[model samples]
Each structure stands twice: as structure tokens, then as C-alpha cells.
Target chain A: MSRRGLLIILSSPSGAGKSTLAGRLRQWDDTLQFSVSATTRAPRPGEVNGQDYYFSSVADFQDQVAAGDMLEHARVFENYYGSPKGPVKTAIESGRDVLFDIDWQGAQQIKNSDLQEHVLSIFILPPSIKELHRRLVSRGQDAPEVIEKRMQKSWDEISHWDGYDYVLVNDDLDTTEDRLKTIIAAERLRRPQQPHLVDHVRKLQSEFGDRP
Target chain B: MSRRGLLIILSSPSGAGKSTLAGRLRQWDDTLQFSVSATTRAPRPGEVNGQDYYFSSVADFQDQVAAGDMLEHARVFENYYGSPKGPVKTAIESGRDVLFDIDWQGAQQIKNSDLQEHVLSIFILPPSIKELHRRLVSRGQDAPEVIEKRMQKSWDEISHWDGYDYVLVNDDLDTTEDRLKTIIAAERLRRPQQPHLVDHVRKLQSEFGDRP
Candidate 1:
């Protein structure tokens, strides 16, 4: 009996280690499929076409949106980004878990979709704002003003923490990773996810003298 | 800054290995307190007071029930049985998870109580009714008629499987135990169970310049 895969959503603010944890989870379980999002933005240097982002023209991305092929989509700074429904559906039906690194809005859209029951959303929080600021500055990618802007946006993201099924205070990396793995393992056993249980329970009923 | 304990309700049909699994869980984590039920029935030979069951008089049991000290209670064969509220309240308030080996009816009562959010109910299912019957026969303690009656009642217990927060098909003891432990570990991390999260989030707020 093949089990249906989980749609794992990992969301966090800018410096909360969501990407790092997602990477570690994938490395821990090679079978997990990382959702490749479709985006209208041009690929950055060294970014592979299909791997980093499913590079799409604005019209193509909008076509996907109009066709209802996008599970969740958002407009960021005049560029469109969205999760493609096809790969996620295929992976889960084949019993492979799909991991999504998206924000709260995207998480909500996924949760409200037809595959709502399959979604397992987790929100990661930095230990403290001081730690968050420290990490953002340490990244060296954004300027101080840009860091300040991101710090302001952090609160908005943190406010949505309660909406997730599980929340992790990312104080320690290893511990958080272990907790995430435990959540995924337990969720996989949920009755709705294991459709084969119908046949299993039917067999048990027959053995109990329900049938001659 | 203390966390509240979980009210873990484990229910299973006879021969589903509920008691064996409960014992193994306690052995694995000594900190988990096993709930000792109060009963008006006379102690069986070798049953210890306060250990096996809190042997109580009918009047005393009625008094406790009137005082709102019984979390859940029921009448069985001209005797009263119940879970005492005092010890469970103290244990959970002091951050000790309490395990209850009660049926679906009791599980429903506890879930509908004030501590509903703290409750974690799990139902165990045997791999097959044939296996269940084999295990009951192997015990060699019950008469064939009693075993047959228990077999008849198994479906009644199994029917309530959907009422629980989690359900495990006990196909293998070791695997089932591992899954149970994982569920507990993840549950402990739930935000409502961790009161210290209030202070943690406050600290984060101050660090974000929300406080002077």
C-alpha cells in the first residue's frame, strides 16, 4: 500500500534559517522533492534554469495563473512568482514529500487549495530580534538600510506564526531539524494520508466474522 | 515560565497490545506519570491500593464526583470507576505529562473538559482481527467464551478510532513505540504547551525596539 506524500510548507522571516533547515531536511531524506517555483524574474548569475527557479516569461507565468495551474502565486516588486501545481501533485501521488519555502500568504493559498489535507505547514522563528538582526547583518548581502527594512517586515511574518500547524523557535539548528523530522514522520502516519488503511480495516472486519 | 503537561489518552481494543505499549512508553520515559484510576470496586487479589487502583467507597467516590475532582467517571457492573482530578491537575501544572489507558468514552469526556487543548488522544488498532484473536487466546487467562465476547467488543472500540487525535495500526511493537515517542516529543513543542514562549516572544519584541 503506497502512502500519499506530504506537502511540507516551511515559512519564516528573512533571517530565521528557514532555507538552511529546508536544505538540511532534503539532505537528510534524499527522496523529498523541493518545490521549484515558477518566476518571471530573470535568473541571477550561476542560477540554473530549472533547479533554482522555473524561469518563465511574464506572459507564461500569467498563463499558468489563468489556467489554474499555479497552486499559489504572488507579485513581488513587479515580478510574479508561484508554485506549479503539476510537479507537486505528481510527487505526492508517487509517495514523495514536497517541501515548499514560501511566505504566509502562499502557505494560506496552499492550505485553502484542493490538497489542503496534504499540507503540513511549519513556521520557524528566530530566538530573538537581536539574533535575527545579527544574522541579517552577518549575511553581508543587504545594506544597513535594507536590513532595517527587512527587520521592520520581520514582525509581519512573526505575527502569522500561530497560523502554522507547528512552530519552531530556531534557537539551535540540530534540535530544530530533529523536531521537524519528527513532525514529518508523525504526519505521514495520519489516517487521511494513508488511504490503504481502508483495505486494511476491511480485511480486519472480514477476519472478525463479518463475512462468511 | 513553566510549561503545562499533556493529557495523553491511549485507547485500544483488547489484544491490541495497549497495556504492553503503555508500559514500554513509561519505561522509555520515567518522567511521564501513569494515571491511577479510582474505583468503588473491591480490590482483586494482589491489587495494591493507590497503585493498581485507588480503591474507594461509593460515598467517597460520590463525594469526589460532587467536588468536581473526577475528570471522567462511569458505572460498570454495579461499581463506579473514574480518574481522580487532583493528582492529574497537580502533575500537569508542574509540567509532568500524564498517561491514561482509558476507553473512547473517557477520552471524549477528557477532550470536552477544560484541559481539552492539553489532551493528546491516540487510538491503537491491531493489524488484523485474526491476529487479535490469536493474541487473546495466547494470553490463556480468559475462558473461550470471555475471549469471544471480547472479540465481539473489539469492533466497538475500533469504531471510535476516528475520535482520537492520532491513530496507530499496531503492526509491529517496536515501530509503534517509536511512532508514539515521536508524537509525544513533537507535541511537547506545541506553542500552547510552552508558557515560557510568552516571555520568549516578549524578549524578541523588546529587541525589536518595541520597548524603551
Candidate 2:
């Protein structure tokens, strides 16, 4: 009796090293399936269309949301982004854990969904605002104005850090990554996650009864 | 803002290797305080008065139970066993995790305690009934009738395994010990366990506000 998979949601402000940590987690366990969100926003350079995100038209995104094909969707300023329900449903039903690297809003939406019981949400915090700003600037990916806007968005995300199962401060990448692995490994041993324990106990019961 | 410590409750049927695993956990983290139980039963040879069990007379045990000194207690066969509340309260208040090697009834009582949010309960299951019997018989601690009686009690204890937060089948001692350590380590990273994280984020918030 195999159980349904967990939805491992990782949320962090920009420059908090969450994306890098998520990548490390996937490398640690290749069984983890990354959830690629569908977005109306244009992909940046080097961003693969289907791999990075399911690039979509606003009309197509709205249609999917209306058709109940989106598990959770939100309008982030000018663009619509959402987790498509189809792939996630298929992954979890087949007993493969789905990893979600989303913001606080997406995490909240997924936590409020019908499959909320299977959700394991974690929030990552950067060491300091100065460090966060430094990392964002060091990325060399955005202009000063864009980085400023992201800094404000980072604060908004960090404000909701209280609403998570586990919260880790990214003071050290190696330590934080190890803790993430430990959390995932331990979560797998929980009673609700291992349905085969039922059969094991039943076998023990029969063996107990058979001892004459 | 240091948080109050967790109450780690470990339960298992006899001969399930819970004791050895618990010993290993204490060795794994010396900060873990073992909540020694006071019992009305007389001490066996080599069992320390305070370290192993706080052997008390029936009247003394009942008095403690009535005086609200006992956190949780129950009569097993002819003897009363209970966890004293004084040391556990002090330990947790000072920010030290306390470990309880107890049965399911005691685990249930602690879960209903006011400190329920801090409770991390785990149950260990033996690999097989035949293996459980072999372990019991190999111990050579009792007569055949006593062994038979304990076998029945083991079954009763295993029946309540569904209530624990995590359940592990003790097929291999080292693996089970490692899993127990992982569970404890991961639980420490939970949001409620680290109240100091509040201070951390507040500092970050100030840092954010100070940025021109």
C-alpha cells in the first residue's frame, strides 16, 4: 500500500539562495519532480520554454484557470502565473514527490488546496539585508532599478516567513542544504507517509495469532 | 527569545530495540535530558535508584500522583509507573529537550498536555513476531510464563502504533538509530522550536528599513 507523495514547497525572498538549494535537493534525490509553472511572462535569455516555465498567452492562462486545470494561480503585477494541476496530480498519484519553488502567495494557495495534508512548506531567510542586496547585485542579471524593485519584493516575501513548517536562515549554504535533506529524509519516515506499515503490522498480527 | 524545549516521546513494544536506540540518541546529543520515571515496583539488580528508575513505595507514588507532581502515570500489572513533572518542567524552561522512554498510554497523556505542541512522539516496531519472541527469549530475564505474558503486552502496545508522529520498523539497529536521530534533528528545525528566529528576522527587518 504505497502512499501519495509530498508537495515539498520551498519559498524564499530573492537572493536568499533558495533556487540553488532547490537545485541541490534535486541532485540529492533525482526522484523529486520539479513543478514547472505556466506563466504569461516572457522568458529571459537561457530560460528554456517548457523546462523553465510553460510560456503561455494571457488568454490561454485564463482559460486553464477557468477550466480548473490550474491548482493555484495568481496575478503578480502584469503577469499571470500558476501551477498546472495536471502534472502535479499525475506525479503525486504515481507516488513521486513534487518540488515547488514558489513565493509565499503560491505556497499559501497550495497549502489551502484540497491536497494540503500532503504539503511540507519551508521558508528560507537570508542572513541579512545587506547580504541579500549584495547577492542580488552580484547576480549581474538585473539593472539597479530592477534590483531595487526586487529588494522591496524580497521584504514582502520575508514578512510571511511565519507561515511555514520549517524556516531556515541561509547563513551557510552547506549547512542549510544538509538540513533540507534531513528534513526531507525524516518526513519520509512519518506514519502517514508510509502506508506499507499497515501491512507490516497486519503481518505481525497474523504471526502473533499463529504462535500456538 | 529562546523557545521552550521539545518533549521527545519514544514508545515501542518490549524487545523492539527502543532502549538501545534511545541510548544511542542520548549519546548522539548529550543535551537531551532523559525523563526518568518513578515506579512502585522494586528495583532489579544493577538498576540505579535515580538514573534508571526512581523506585518509590506505593504510598509515595500515589501521593506524588495526587499532588500533581506526576505528569503522566498508569498501573502496569501490580506496579504504578509515572513521569515526574518537576525536572521535565525545569529542563524545558531552560531550553533543553527532554526524552521520554514510555509506553503508549504515557505518550497519549503527554500529547494532551499543555506542552502538546512541543511533543515529538515516535514508535518503533519489531521486524517480525518471531524475531520479537527470539529477542525476548534471548534476554533470559524471566520464566517462560513471564515471557508469554510480556509477549501479550507487546501485542497490546504495538496495536497503538498508529498514533505516533513517526513509526519505524527496527529491522537493523544502526539504521533505526540513524532514523531516530534524523527525526529529532529535523524536528529541531521546526518553526516553533526556534523562537530566536524571530529576533533574527527582526534584525533583518531593521536592516531592510535602514537601507536608503
Candidate 3:
């Protein structure tokens, strides 16, 4: 029988290299997969249906919520977005680790649910707030006022660092990426992942295996 | 204020490439230091006095055990060996991560003591029992019978793998080393390790910091 997969939840503030590290982790290991979240928000022009996200109507999302199909759902910027419990459960049961690149709030919601033990949490922090603001402005995705709002949001997000099982400081992308890969490998070897090995080894004794 | 360094306890079977990984970890990060254990066993001719193991007398070891100066102590192969609590306390207080290349039993003793919260436990496993036996025999220092005995001991040692907080499978040496390094980096960014940064960032509020 194939062993089950682990659930890894990674949370980070804006500009903390969460997406970058998550991408590298998936690339480094084929057994690891990403959980595509479902969203009620309309997808932009270039977004693919399943590749980008599982797009659904507001009504469909509400139905999933009411039926307990959504693992963790939230309303953001006047639109609802959530992680579909079905795909994640299927992936893990079939021996593929699912990576969740969600925020601290979403991670907490998932942790509070029945899937808590399956989730391995990691929080990322920039080396300093000064560096965080610098990176956010460097991206140039937002105006000065919006950047200020993001900076404020970062503080509140960073305060939840202690809630995580592991924390990574994004001082350099290369080093941080390397660390993320290692964490995945280590967590994969957890005892629960290799239950059959113990019995398999013991059975070798009955087969007259080579020994002293 | 300086951050407190974490005490990392690594336990694994003898030929699981743990020492190689631990050595590479120390080379990659200067902030990490090794905890030289004290032992009553006679040092080999080529073994350096303080550099290899702190050569202590049976009486000296028992005295420390009675005085409660050792973090963890035990007798192995008719010789007393232990880790002193004082040096570990001083090193961690000075912001240096101390590594304990110990067995699971010693790690358990440390875990039970007051150092439980600060301790990060990692257990290493070889990819397979066949691979482990190959590595052990390849060393060529032991006879066939001796290698078999060591393999049996390795099985006993690995049976307690679940006691660790993290588990690393040494399938690839370089990858395993990288994984261990990342685990250390992630632990260093934990909230308890960054207390000074809390108020330090608050000072940057006037520059652009606003709490959401």
C-alpha cells in the first residue's frame, strides 16, 4: 500500500519570499504538490481555470461553505476565496504532499479544523521591517498609500509568528529556498509516513536473511 | 538584547550519515557550535584530549552526576559519558546554537529536563536497511560478526524514531545536509528568537510603519 502524504502550511507577510520558496520546493520534489484554492472572484484574462484557481460563482462558494466542503474560506476585498477540501484530501490520500501558501489567518482556520495534525506550519519573516517596506515598494505593484496599508498589515501578520511550528527569515532567496527544500524532506520522513518499513524489516528475520 | 540560541539534539543510528551532516552544518554556519561530551572511556591514542572528548575519571563523572551539573548522563559499554549543563547554558546564552550528537536515550533525558522548550530534536534514518548494512560493512573497521551486531544495535536505536520532532532520511548526503541547515535557520526565526526585533521595528513606525 502507498503511504499517505503530509500537509505543509506556509504563511508569510508580503514580500517575504513565500511564493518563491513554495515554487522552489515543488520544483525540487516531484511528490510534493500545490493546493489550488477556489475563488468567487473573477479570474483575470491570463488565468487558466484549473491551473490558476478553481473559479466558482459566489453562490457555489456559499453552497460549499454550508455543506462543509470548503476547508477554510474567507471574504477578501468583497469576494470570497477558499481552499476546497476535496482536492487536498484526494492528493494526500494518494501519496502526494500538498503545499498551502496561505496567510496566517487562513492557516489558523485550517489548523482549527479536523486536519490539524496533517498540517505542518511554517511562517516566513523578512530580515527586518525596513527591508520589508523596501521590497514592497520595489515591486511597484501598489501606490504609496496602498504600500503604507500593506506595511501596516505586515505588522499585524508578523505578530502571529510564534503560532507557527517553523519560521524562516528571508535574508536571501537562495539560502531560504535551500532551507525550504530541506524542511520538506525532513517532514516527509516522519514516522507516520513509513509505518510499513518497521514490519517489513522484521519479517526479513523469518526468511533466513544473511546474518552472523 | 541578544537572542537565545536553540539547543538542537540530533539522534540517529551509527552509520546513517548523521556525523557527516552535523559536521557540514557547523562548517556552513559559524553561529553553530558543537557540544563536546564528557566521557570516562579511555580516549584512543590519536584522539585529542579536549577536542575529541573531555576525558574524565569515573569519580569525576559520578561527582558531576551527583551535583546535577550534567544535562544528560548515561553508561554505554561499561563507560560513563555525559553532557555538562553549564557549558551548554553559557554557549546558548551567548547566541550560539549548540548541537548534541547523542543517542535517543540521552536526548530523552534532555527533553525531560527544563531544556524541553529550547530543544529541537531530529532523528535521521538511512534510506533502507540494506543500504545501512552496506554502509556499515564498507567501513571495514569491524568484522562481519561485529557489523551484524552494530546493525542490530542500529535497529534498536532507530525504533524510537517517533520521539523526535523532526525526522530526516539520509537518502542523499548533500540534500540531507541542506535539509538540516534549513531546519536550523527556520528555528532561529521563531518569535522567541526575535524579541529585540519587536521594539526595533516599532521605532520605524514614524518612517512608514502603521499597525493594521
Candidate 4:
């Protein structure tokens, strides 16, 4: 029988190269799934209706929250965003690990959920505040005021970094990417992630019993 | 600040290829130390004094045990065997990972020791009991009764496989060797294993503080 899958939560502040790393991880293992979050925020330009997010009405988002459909949710500014529990549960139960690209707040929620035992959370840190600011400003030509606001928000996320099982500084993209792959590959070998081992051992035991 | 090292514990039955795998692991990384256990048993053929086993007198072994120099000790049939606590404490504190090739009892004792937090235990299972028997018999032209006794002792060890953090079936030497390397590489990336990360983050914090 297939073992249960890991939550594989990846948390980082904005512009920490988490998105690029996540993309690389998926390419390395196509079986790895991205947990598409549902949000009440209007889609940004060039964003697909369902691919970027499962856009939902404010009322529907709240309804799912009330019905316990969201694995974790948060109100960020004017929008409501969350991971729906059904797809994640289905994917994990079938032994397909689901990757969550989320902030610490959502991470804490899922860690406290019933499926907490299956969660493997990691936090990524920027090499330095200077580098973080560089990436933030490099993204788009935002006004100085907007950039300042984003900087404070990024710091807010970085301050909560100590809550993860593994933390890596995104010093070099290639090094960080390779390290992430190593972490994932090793985690898959953990005892809880390989239930079929029990059967293998049982077969050996029987084989021993039948010996001369 | 350098992080503390792990006590990499590897346990398996007599003929499960644990020795070969351990040899390959040491070859893969010379810095990985083999924890030379002190035993009161007589030196076997072709075994070196310090490299193979630290052959000790029974009185000396018991004295070390009484003085608490032994990390974990156990008696098998007639002889006492144990891991010395001194070298391990020094190696780990100095950030050099130590490898322990001991039985389940010693593994459990170390897991319960003060340095339990630094322990990373793994168990190797043979692909089949028939193969295990084949390996045991193939070693020498022993009497059937001696082989039978060995088989029972091997089963005794195999029964405790579930206590390990990671368990692998030794179906192929190269595959198991690679997997062992992967486990070690990933474990090194764990949060607790990287104390210098704290300092790095503090530097980043100061970098942010200096910003306008």
C-alpha cells in the first residue's frame, strides 16, 4: 500500500526566490503537486481564472470557511485567501505529496490541523535585507511609497521564520534549488513516508519461518 | 557558530550487508567517523586492535561502565560491549558527525541518553531471510548448528527494526549507499543542525535596520 503524502509546506517572505525554487522542484518531480489556493481577490492581469487561483466570491469564501472546507485561510488586506481542504486531503491520501507556498500564518494553521503529522514545513530566508529589498524593487516599477510598504510586509514574514522544521538562506538560486531537492528526496525516505516497508519485513519474516 | 554534529546510528542483523554499506559510507565521506566500540570479547581473526574493535579487559570495561564513560553498553552471551562517551561528546561538540554500528539495545540506550537530540538512527533490512541465511553460511564453512544459532540471533535483531528513524531494505548495495547519502545530506540541512543560521539572520536584521 502507498504511504501517506507530506504537506511539504514552503514559507518565505516576498522576493526570497521561493516561487522559482518551487517551479524547479515541480519540474524535477512532475508527481509533486502545487496546492492551488482559493481567493476572493480579483485576478491580476495575465492571470488565469483557475490556474493562478480558484477565484471565489467573498460570500463563497466565507461559506467554505464556515463549512471547514479551507485547510487554512487568512484575510490579507481586502482579499480572503485559503487552501481548500478537499483537494489536499484527496491528493495526500492517495500518496501524492502536495506543496504549499504560503506564509507563516497559514502554515501555523495547517500544522495545527488534524493532518499535522503529515506536514513537513520549511522556511526560506533571503541572503540579506539588501538582497531582499533589491528583489522587491526589481519586480516592478512601484512608487517609493509602495516599495516601502512592501518592505515592511516582507520583514513581517521574515520575523516569524523560526517556526519551520527546515530553513535555508536563498544565497544562490542553483545551490538553494539543489538543497531543496535533497531535502525533499531525503524526507521521502523517512519511516512514516514508507508504509510498504512493514509488508516487506513481514514477507521476510515468513520467509525465515519457512527455512530449514 | 558551528552547529553540533549527529550521532549517525546504523543497525542491522549479522548478514544484512550493514558492514559493507558502512564501509562505502566512510569511503564516500572520510570526515564521517566510525564510532569504535570497546568490547571485552577476544579479537577475531584478521581484526585490528583499535580499528576493528577496541579490545578491552573485562575489569577495564566494567570500570569504564561504572565511571560513566560508556554511552551505552550491553552483554551478549558472555562479553560486554559499549560505546565510549568521551570521543563522541568531543566529536559532536566540535561539529564532526560520528557513526555508530551497534545493536538495537545500544541504539535504544543512546536514544534515551542526554545527547538523544543529536541522534539519527537508521536500520537496514536484508532483501530476504533466505538471502540473509545465504550470506551467513557463505561467510565460512561453519557447522549447521552454528549457522542455526546465528539465524536466531539475526531474527532477534530484525524484530526491532521499527524503532529506527529511517529503515531501508538492502536490495542493492549501490542503491542503498546512495539513499544513505541522501538521508545524511538532507539531515545536515535540518534547522537544529545549522546554528550558524541564527547568526546569519541576525546580520540580515541589522542590514535591514540600516536601511532608510
Model 3 regions more than 4 Å off: A1-8, A15-34, A39-68, A75-80, A93-97, A117-120, A124-152, A166-212, B1-6, B15-33, B39-68, B75-80, B126-152, B166-212
Please report the candidate that would top DockQ against the real structure.
2
True C-alpha contacts between chains kept, each model in order: 0.57, 0.86, 0.31, 0.81
lDDT of 1 by residue, A32-146 (tens): 9999999999899999987999999999999999999999999999999999999999999989999999999999999999999899999999998878888888988877789
Docking class of 1: medium
Runs in model 2 lying further than 4 Å from the true structure: A1-4, A40-50, A55-69, A140-145, B1-4, B40-50, B54-69, B76-79, B141-145
Name model 4 segments beyond 4 Å from true: A2-4, A40-50, A55-69, A77-79, B1-3, B40-69
Model 3 per-residue lDDT tens digits across residues A1-212: 34667779989888888888887787788778888899988899999988799999999999999998888989999999899999888987787889888888889888887767677788887877777888899997788899988887887888787788767777789987876766665666555655554564455343315543
Quality of candidate 4 docking, DockQ: 0.70
For model 1, name the residue pairs that clash: none
**What would the TM-scores of all predictions be?**
0.89, 0.88, 0.70, 0.89
Q: Rank order by TM-score, top first?
A: 4, 1, 2, 3
Residue-level lDDT tens digits of model 3 in B1-212:
56778889999888889888888887898778889899999999899977888999999999999998898999888999899988888887778889999998999999997767788888887777777888888888788779878888888888787788777778799888877876776666555665665564455444443433
Candidate 2's TM-score reads 0.88
Docking class of 2: medium
Candidate 1 has a TM-score of 0.89
Query: What tens digits encode model 2's per-residue C-alpha lDDT throughout B1-212?
Result: 47668899999999999889988888988999999999999899899998999999999999998898888999989999999988898888888999998899999999987778889999999999999999999998789899999999999999999999999999999999889888988998899889889999999999999997
Model 1 C-alpha lDDT per residue in residues B1-212, reported as the tens digit of each score: 47889999999998999999999999999989999999999999999998999999999999999998899999998999999989998999899999999998999989888888899899899998878888888988888788888877888888778888788899899999999998898888777788786777677777777622
Clashing pairs in model 4, backbone N/Cα/C closer than 3 A = none
Q: Please provide, for model 4 over A70-157, each residue's C-alpha lDDT reduced to its tens digit, 9 standing for 90 to 100.
A: 9899998999999999889888888899999999999999999888878889999998898889989999989999999998988899
lDDT, model 3, position B18: 86
